[model samples]
Target: MPVWGWILIAVIVVIAVVAVIVARLVSSRQRTERLRGRFGPEYERTVGEVGNLDAAEDELAARERKREKLDIVSLPPEARAKYADSWRTVQIEFVDNPSSAVGAADRLVIQVMRERGYPIDDFDQRAADISVDHPKVVENYRRAHSIYLAQEQGDVGTEDQREAFVHYRALFEQLLETDENKDKPKETRA
Candidate 1:
């Protein structure tokens, strides 16, 4: 009711506001760090595309949420073996028919994704969905896809085709790995 009482109330109100602001800042920072750690280069790419930190984080979070609702599963042992053999064949084909080989690699990667319960209808969406689980290799998928498209137009060189195949291999290798078996070391390729 007096001047001193009003001054104390105002100070308390200011302190509460400051505390809320600090809490929010801490929360935002933690979210940024977690997304950066999980997404790696994908995080930077998303931010660059979206042109805002909050929007990029929101998009990434949406991808994670969308992926969580799916029934994505790992390949069975036999299927894994078959895909490995198929990949070997594709790689060998690259030596003589690089363009066809890269296209086959693209198809093989999509098939692996489909077998793993990912939607294969849309390339961009597929890449985004795959990014949730395989963040590190999604960029490789993009680069490979771009090269494949260019190859169809007869604009890509042999060197570019080779690079695309290598990029596809990176993603194919990633697709072959599931959370259960990811910790073990990779086998050497012939």
Candidate 2:
């Protein structure tokens, strides 16, 4: 081959390689942004836990995939209202029995999840699945579960029990919200 032809071929190959590299970098950045936006703080926490960006993103992506297979649905207005009433009762009980109230709250949250088509066989798995749609409150769910565990040991104080109730409420409220009733007055959400 002529020298000029050889040089031209080499330049072409280099440009192709550079283009591939640029395309890959752009793709990686876009994936990161999409996952971060969807998961919110859960994205940061998972990355910190896994200590690798790719692995954490993969885990979060898996949650999305798993969630897609589930039959999660919003509660009907009547059911939503009933659960809200139950939650109010739990809160009222918190005044006299904070520890028991925390336990009731935990059970209530799980019942809501179960009724909404989320699997409740395991807490960790349940949280992972919930994180897909409710990233902001999954951490709250974790915190509340931890508190519930501590409460079972009788090592938690009233304040901690109250905190757990609040966390459960966060997740509960999110689960209760749906497009059909989001704009309704709180009293009529049921």
Candidate 3:
């Protein structure tokens, strides 16, 4: 091959590579900006809700303890031997459903917050109030949970589903935090 031809090919390759790199960079930046714009102040507030994190952590720990204590129930006689331990393991693993884990975690936070005298309300009514579902909290939880599950299962692209998962998780977490904050004791005058 002629040297000029070789040099021309090299330049063409370099231009193609540079174009791809620039395109990828632009796409990534746009995705980040979209997420920021979509989530906005609510995202920041949700991230700042320390109480929700603490509550979720505590509830997860409690679930582990409860799993240890659950009575081992028998399956049907024909399947009992093969499925006995299987059932227990599934229960321990949140019924082998990642979405269930998210729901459980959210419910645990709400329960803890309510026990702490938070004004936690019905999930159904909250959903209706938000004009989404009758059980707003659970509906949001499931949507976010499903995104997480889809991401885990490799059923969708991570970036899009992850953005959705984080967004809904934040919304629900903030709801719990707001419920908890509403129940805070008022300051007494000296």
Candidate 4:
């Protein structure tokens, strides 16, 4: 090819590559921001739910029906398990698997709690001195309880499934270490 033709082709390729990179970066940044907003709340919710297994199961069941009815929550049982397991892991951090960290779960939990009059504060102490017996806390516990139960029936992959389950377990255990809920006094002890 002629020198000019080669130069033109090179320039076009460079532009295309740059454009793709920029698009990817922007997309990733938006996702990160959304996730950042939810992390603390999700961890907190997990902690509260794991502290009370029955309530968590009930909460999971309710969410499952809502998601299915809406037709917007279409994850495979495995994926749902991943999510539930992740929450469980967030509740009790162990060395088995990783956490299923999704922004939607965080946002949904927050919105539901807010609607139920749950007092959600920032991660710090100044946010809110909430107790388990508080109305909001009770509501949150119920929500988490149901969601956790729905996840119990999930199937894991032969290799990856085990890892995923392990990760979920680990995530919950890990959450316990930094469980903000621990700071709150348990009223019902459920």
Question: Which residue pairs overlap in candidate 1's backbone?
Answer: none
Candidate 1 error regions (>4 Å): 178-190
What tens-digit string does per-residue lDDT give for candidate 1 at 1-190?
9999999999999999999999999999999999999899999999999999999999999999999999999888789889999999999999999999999999999999999999999999999998999888788889889999999999999988988888888778777885654623232331
lDDT of each: 0.89, 0.88, 0.43, 0.39
lDDT of 3: 0.43
Residue 89 CA displacement from its true place in model 2, Å:
0.9
The alpha-carbon deviation from the true structure for residue 29 of candidate 3, after best TM-score superposition, in angstroms, is: 0.8
Instruction: Give the higher-lDDT candidate: 2 or 3.
Output: 2
Residue 7 lDDT in candidate 1: 100
Candidate 4, which ten residues in sequence have the lowest lDDT sum? 124-133
lDDT of 1 at 99: 93
Q: What are the per-residue Cα lDDT tens digits for candidate 3 across 21-112?
A: 99998976675454335344323333355346445334333433543453423223444333324323423544355444444444543443
TM-score for all models, in order of appearance: 0.93, 0.93, 0.28, 0.27
Error of 2 at 138 (Å): 1.1
